[model samples]
Target chain A: MVDVNMTLEMVQASQVGMKAIGAGIAVGLTGIGAGVAEMAIGSAAVGATAENKDVFGLVLLLTVIPETIVIFGLVVGLLLLF
Target chain B: MLKPEQMSRLLIVASKDQMAPVVTELYRHNLFHIEDYVEAGAEGYEGFKIGSPLPGATEASGDLVKIRAIENAFSIRSEDFEVKQRRKQSGLQVLIEHELPAIEQEVEGLTVNRSKLETKLKEYEQKIAELTPFTGIPGDLDLYRGYSRLVVFAGYVEKEVSLSVPHEMFFSKGKGRHFTVVIAAVEQRSVVEGALQEAGYQAVPIPDESGVPQERISFYSSQITLIKKEIEDINQKLDAIKEKHADFLVACEEILKVQVDQTEAPLRFATTNETFVAEGWVPTNRVDAVSDSLTNVTGGKIFITVLPIDLEHDVVPVEYDNPSFAKPTQMLMDVYSRPKYAELDPTLILSIMFPLFFGLILGDVGYGLLLLGMCLVLRKYLKVDDGAQLLTVLRNASFSSILFGLLYSEFLGFELPWKPIMFSRHLKIGGGEAGGQGPAIPELMMLAIWIGILHITLGRILGMINHARQDHGDHRIKAVMANFGWLAVMWGLLIVIWTIAALPLMPDLTSLPKIFINLNAAAIVGAVLLVTGVILIARDSALEIVELPTIISHVLSYARIVAVGLSSVAIAMVVNFIAIGMLISPQLEHITVVGVLFIIMGVVVFLIGHALNMALGILGGGLHSIRLHYVEFFTKFYKGGGKKYSPFGYKRRFTED
Candidate 1:
């Protein structure tokens, strides 16, 4: 009876570990999403700035707009962990 | 000193003959910005024709072209090539007239001869390749040509064709080679060529030579070797010429370019049959010096008159006169827009704000150290031409990050041993008695908003100062009224927002009566200031009232600083949690094999996670900082579209003068 209870307790603890794993997947995927967004915008920003530096302010703002997505991901992930 | 340099409009009238001398004097002074002279015939102000370039201008440009060619040939640069001196004008003239042309002619002759040799050598190689297969055949005494009826194809034939051809017509069967020589009739030529092609045959017509194929091969081979040697010898001579004339070419180009520029300056002025009128802007302090020099040089025949301020006509060029620390920021300003000549130079403020914003967003000591180390490495080793100032800005940002890092007690998202002097919501900062609360999103937001208020206020103040400093004449009151009204409105708006945002953060001080009183006061002040600003602004443009939201948005934009910092720290914290969990898990301690594997996995996670965080930190921190300054801060006071003051002068590289 004691052995069955110990095994049941291990199963419960392993299930609890799934929360951390879920948080990891969420943040990791969103980070990738942000990276992909930046990849497109960053190239365009570089190209625009190369041609006429006046558009730098606009380009910088556009390029970092995707950063907000990552920040949102981070908050959601941190909330899950703590 | 805070404003752009003062400029005075100058109109100089000089004789056509004296234009070159006068231009030389102006360039020597290097304080004049020549305005392009436009024809005013439509408005009925045309007697002065646009000045033509002087006679010497053509010659000087001609010399410059030749010098450039020589420089290209030798691959000479002023920086790399050590010039003996700023070759005197007469020395350059002599070289241009004598030595340069001689060396050019000599090099041209050698190159021409070498090319001829190369072509002959290539022809010989072609003959050798053709004659190589026929070396087995003995005779070559013009035997392969001038035979239309015989259809003599003295070339390689298929081995199968060898049997067929010898039977049909005379042919040579090569020993142990795939192709053989063949001779066939005109009627059989098409059929024979078809068979040859099927057997993968190729044609090699015998050359018109008077020797056996072997002897001819040897002769061509020897000639090719001799030609190659001669070409090598010519190359050595060319190398000698390059070494001798490279520095001289660079120096000559600089001196001649200056001459060409001076001689061409007349084209910007307006000239008639006898006299020319040169109109341009010169800084006020240097105007007297320019006037004195032109007078001294032209024997006082020229009259330099300082025209009164022409508001309706003149577009004053802007020259920023900032100290060295702020000079790099000037590049950033110029990259965006040059401030109007009448406005304040924002270089000093940008130099401070840009790095601080960068640091605030990237508040971690480890990353700062990495950045500093990378910068030191780059500066120490790389010889970059354009990115030097970028490195300096990065270094300044790195330093600020380090300072903030210490205050926040963060070193790669790990809390430092010492207590944090400044609180950061994203950091534990310290433990037990030494620590306070970690990051709270609301408080961070409030702090960001407050910083935004301070930064934008400074911009408004500077802008107001700029307006007040302008020679508004009778419009000064209106300028002050509008500018001050806007300033008051911004301050009032900040107070109203702060009172609400900081209420929860200041929970201890929150009371019903105090909240009501503060809210009432802030609302009244904000409403009054907004009404006053709208009234003053309505005098200029009622459209500006539509931009009320822009002010609020600019302040809200500062939240990105805290948001980006929080993300950087949170990602790092997550990385550490996973990594440390792997190493010190209670479940895995007894299982040594699993523990070892976990440690490996943990280290990889740590590296990859931190690397990702680092990249994002740089991109977000650097760009958001720049965006804040350019959009939020610069819009407060700065309006770009100033003409860059470029005086007609040379920052000489190879020459002293």
Candidate 2:
């Protein structure tokens, strides 16, 4: 019974470790995806802002639109961890 | 308050004699948004042409030009100066007719004199530099010139040269070289050139001068000083004139600007040889007052008519008519686009929701108070119209943040004396396992999701109303149904999740009566609603069925509220830990010199760390909150390419008619 309990504990610990790794990958890869999506948008927003200052708020909104991808990833990661 | 002010299309036809009175009456009302008459020759108006300026326009324009020049010289901007009392129109007319020309003449003379003196000073300075290299050599400048038979090379040489031909050489030390003057026979040009090349000689042009180099430099220096003094005197005179006449000149400019505008008003009108026609938009409520005043001024001889609006063709200018409290949010609306005349204005919604989202993300009392103080100071000192409005928006956000801070029981990432009335944002997974105190990660995430669901649903409702109200004809019903379909999908998904996940604050589906063998009432209802929503959406546009997953992503996107807040709390906690725990607290056990030094270091780290975190919180909180509104909420209903209403009259600042 002692050996069986040890084996059960080992399996549980490895499962926790694997879940942690999965959570990290979910958040990390999505963060990269968001950054790549924002790269083109951020530059275009800045360029438009330079020509006309009145578009500042609109450009800012456009610049952060892709960041929602990362937010979704965060929700997924939290779901996995907890 | 939700809709823009209604506009009426106004048309006025008047004989040539009544044109002046019509223009004056329109300016007095200051409510006319004129549409410039284009030369398209549409329908029966082939003979109509754009009118030339009135009789006095040329003189008024010329006077305006002179006043602007003087204002430029004094560096005076109308907005920069405050008038204690408005100047009377009669007094300004006297200043413009008699005193303006004299002032203009005096200012022009002084500027011209100053520029000439400046040019002379530059010439003298250049001459002084040319004479500087010659000063090292001790001969009179006359010796280097006026020698027909002698060839003089007056410049620097690398080394001493023993000329093969008979020659006379004078050498003196200069900057990094020997300043040498060699007078050799002109007939021995080849031999002298070869000898000078061997010595690495560089040639300098002899000046056409007949005096000592030292005396000439002194002469040019004194002349430069004289010219500089004369220039200074001219500038002082100009400054004195500016100080005395600044008020009069600014008032004159304002009067002339109004005159020019009035005189040039006809340029935008369409006219024939005997009569003129002007068309524009005015607020519906003010149409009666404008018509009565114009008729009263023109003795009822002019023809005034309200043209019928064509929804398909007529271009109406949009003007926002909001309450005083919501006026500042118009700037934010303008940053995106103004609402069309027929569409609902979202400024009121933005005014409330924007601050709430900002507060949710940055719920810290200390940061809130700091931002509040900054906004107040800026609003007080900044006189710019747009800047003041922006500061008011920020001030509102700051107040919201303070309210949320009270709820969260947070002061700069630290817990307050009392327990948080709401869930603590600093908690992560297994937070309840440690102390069973505040809410854990799942609860906070669920709260953000709920907010998203409600917010998105509100957006869909607004979208339905917008589609119905707009002139969509037969397709209006379908458009509204599409919006309803989106709403149904969102709520259906939420209901399904509530039954499956058993999350907090969600209804217990098990407690309700079961409708089927294995399913409860809520589950069967949710599945039916989901299927119905899908069918409704497909009925509108078959392709839009592919965008169904987008609703889920949109709802999940609100999870950023918790994620961002937690990241900020984490940073503040790390900063405090590193500054106090690692640096200061360990050394506090002993009051040695090293301990005192470490304490000071820790204090520096603490201040810098909090400052950085505060800036990041403001930027992140403000941008993300506005993004939720503009990107997610507005995309549902807002279709904004409205023409901005610009009236024809000026708000007189310096002179009043």
- Candidate 1, residues B460-526, lDDT tens digits: the string is 7776777677646756666666667667767666555554554444322122235344555555666
Please report, in order, the local distance difference test score of every candidate based on alpha carbons.
0.75, 0.84
lDDT of 2 by residue, A1-82 (tens): 2355567778888889888999899899999999999999999999999998667667776787778788778878998987
The CAPRI class of candidate 1 is incorrect
Query: Distance from true position, residue B3, model 1, in Å?
Result: 1.8
Per-candidate alpha-carbon RMSD to the true structure: 7.4, 4.3
Q: Give per-residue CA lDDT, model 2, range B56-172, as digits (tens).
A: 899988999998998898798887787867889997898789999999999999998888888888888877777887887788998887767888887778888888789988888
User: Stretches of candidate 2 above 4 Å error?
Assistant: A1-32, A48-62, A80-82, B132-143, B150-229, B427-439, B505-528, B542-546, B575-603
Error of 2 at B423 (Å): 1.4
- Which stretches of candidate 1 lie above 4 Å from their native place? A1-82, B40-45, B79-87, B111-236, B363-386, B409-417, B424-446, B460-510, B514-553, B563-621
Calculate each model's fnat, 2 decimals: 0.12, 0.72
